[model samples]
Target: MYRIGVDLGGTNIAVGIVDEKYKIIAQNSTKTKRERGAKAIVKDIALLIEDLLRKTGIKVDEICSAGIGVPGAVDTKKGVVTFSNNFDFKSTELKKMLKDTTGFDFFVANDANAAAFGEYIAGSGKGSDNFVLMTIGTGIGAGIVINGKIYTGVNGAAAEIGHTVIVKDGIPCSCGRKGCFERYASASALTSMAQNAAEENTNSELYKLCGGDIKKIEGRTVFAAIEKNDKTAGEVLDKFIEYLAVGVTNIVNALQPDVLAIGGGVSAAGDVLINPLKQRVQIEDYARFCELKTIIKAAVLSNDAGIIGAAYLDLT
Candidate 1:
């Protein structure tokens, strides 16, 4: 028997067919034009699933179930998306729609939670029961896996690690809170830091990389500048890592998870990002409480984690 997973994102929707072993036998993706509205988006997903099953030669009866990971608040038990900023989906019965269209049992979960489960079961945290999967991209999102299961709390909205306060009155976050972890630790934060540094250090290579337009500076541009040993870029990265470590240290001290798996675009910095973060955890993570020896590592399933994890939600 097979299972289908759909990862619906702001720009694209990834669909995959997986075997019982959790290996993706066939995968495909299509652009998500959210302006087309919720109904169109659901239709697109249904079509993609149908096309994928045909391409993989898997019958509907041969599939055990289907799962969808949505980028928003989800009522998992009700199979509804409460609200989503990535698309025009609010109070929509996502699971029922898919089931009606494809005639398969379906499940729905928060995208980050799905990614976390995927990593825990088949990727980096495979052997660990308790860990935090933090995705540091445009925003920071986290999934808490405890006792070999995804913990969504009572309302299915727990593990919002990004909103954890880091500074008293520092940068403002989109969540209407000041000094949220994502404000300083995310890829968007790194890019913003680079742009601010470029403005102050006109002679820095980052200025040239941004074509002298601070507004054009991006996370990759800053990473490239740091690669060339640019002092200003390195300084921005150092500060960025410091804030990231501060938030992570807090998680370590509080949750005492067995591991912290870092994913998303910022994690691409690899050792440069992981090393200092680890050091900070050792130095300031309220170590007296739990002897925080939690291991920190990069996520193994880069892009496909959400799709694969969503597919396995039924098993969980």
Candidate 2:
């Protein structure tokens, strides 16, 4: 039988029909219109699911169950979104809402965790019992799978690796902390670093690439400058990689997952990012002496990971 997965984001609600082969056979999506409130958002999700089913000519009986991945702390056992700053959700009975609206059993999980589980079963983390996926976007988000299961702590809000401090009394973070890993290691951080470097080095390719306007500086801008053999851009990248390595080493020491997959926009640099990160982690990780090491690679599923992972939440 097929399964239904919903990726509920602040901006959009995406629904997918997953076949037995773990592929999304049909999909539908619409703006979340969250300002209309949680009830309206849930209603839209149900509508999307129905539309997908109708388009695919699949009956409700053909669906085994449905799952949702939300962007907030969730009480998975109770299907309640404990809190979500994005939607101002508080104690929202998400599971019951989906079931009442669609007449189907529903499972709920954090979106990042769902993506990691997707990779664990079908992508980079496949065949690994212990896995971790870190998506470094505007901020860094992490999901941990241990011993063949997603590890949501007692409160269902675990594996927040980004907020962990790597530099004592360093740059301030929006989370009201100093030196949080994301502040120095995320894609946003990389952009900021490149902009600042361009400002200081007027003759560098970074400055020319951004046309002397730091405001135009972006994550990809840095990579472009480095491709031009720019020294300043290279230095900025080295520092960014160093900071990222520190955070990665901390996670490796703490969890020692069998596989750690890197995702998000910056990871598109592929081996340019992964190769350096592996070299740095090799030198810094506490397990350097061990014959075996955690396999670090780029996540393969990309945007589809959340939907695929959500579809298989029943396995967790």
Candidate 3:
């Protein structure tokens, strides 16, 4: 049998037809067009699913349950999207709307949590029962898995590690908080740091990479400069990596999971990010010389994690 998985994001809505093996056998996508309102978006989602099923020639009976990954807080039991800042959604009854529009029931979860479950079951966390996934992109998102299950707490909103305060009275966060760990450690933070360095150090390779435009600086800017031995870029990278380590060390100290996996575009740096993280975490983690340590690795799945994980939302 097949299952439908929908990853509803601010920019796009991706639909996947996944088989029992967790493979996305068929897929479809469309712009979310949030400006059209949530009702239109939900209608488009239904249309997309029907189109995929028709193209694949899969009858409704051949499909099992469906799941959707929302980029916000979800009330799983209530099947409500409590909040989604990216889409400006609040208390959206996504599951009910889908059922009404398409006559199919679905499970819903936070997109990051779904991806973490996907990684735990089929990617980097495959062999471990307890896993942690840290995705560093425009922001920082974490997914925690324990005993082979997503560790969403009482109201299914646990493991928001990114919001934890790192530096008291530090930078402001979009969440209306100050000194959030994500503000200091996310790839966005790195890019901002790089942009400042590039603007200040015109002679550095980073500035050249950005073509003298500070707005053009990105996560790779500092790394490119570091390769060329640019002093300012190296300094920026060091500070960013140190900030990343501080939060990771906190996770290790708090949860002590079996594996800690990194995900998102920044993870593309691979060893450039991992090697330094290893060193910083080693020196800063609570159990420096423990017999067993959390195995830090990169997530194997790049972007399809949400699809696979969402497809398996009813696995329990």
Spell out the clash pairs found in candidate 1: none
Model 3 per-residue lDDT tens digits across residues 63-110 = 888998888888988789887777867898988988999788989899
Worst 10 residues of 2 by lDDT: 81-90
lDDT of 1 by residue, 135-226 (tens): 99989999999998888878777788999889999788778899899988888888888999999999999998888999999888887897
Ranking by lDDT: 2, 3, 1
In Å, residue 65's CA in model 3 sits off its true spot by 2.2
- Most lDDT-accurate candidate: 2
Cα shift from native, residue 269, model 2 (Å): 0.8
Order of the predicted models by TM-score, top scorer first: 2, 3, 1
User: What CA RMSD would candidate 3 show?
Assistant: 1.5
**Candidate 2 per-residue C-alpha lDDT over 1-316 given as tens digits, one digit per residue, 9 for 90 to 100:** 9999888877778889988877999888899887788888888887898788888899999999789899889899999999886786899998998889988888999999999998999999999999999999988999999987899998878988999999999999888999999999999999999998999999999999978899999999888988999999999999999999999999999988999999999989888789999999999889999988999999998878889999999999
How many pairs collide in each candidate, listed in order? Answer: 0, 0, 0
Candidate 2 lands at a TM-score of: 0.97
Candidate 1 vs 3: which has more lDDT: 3
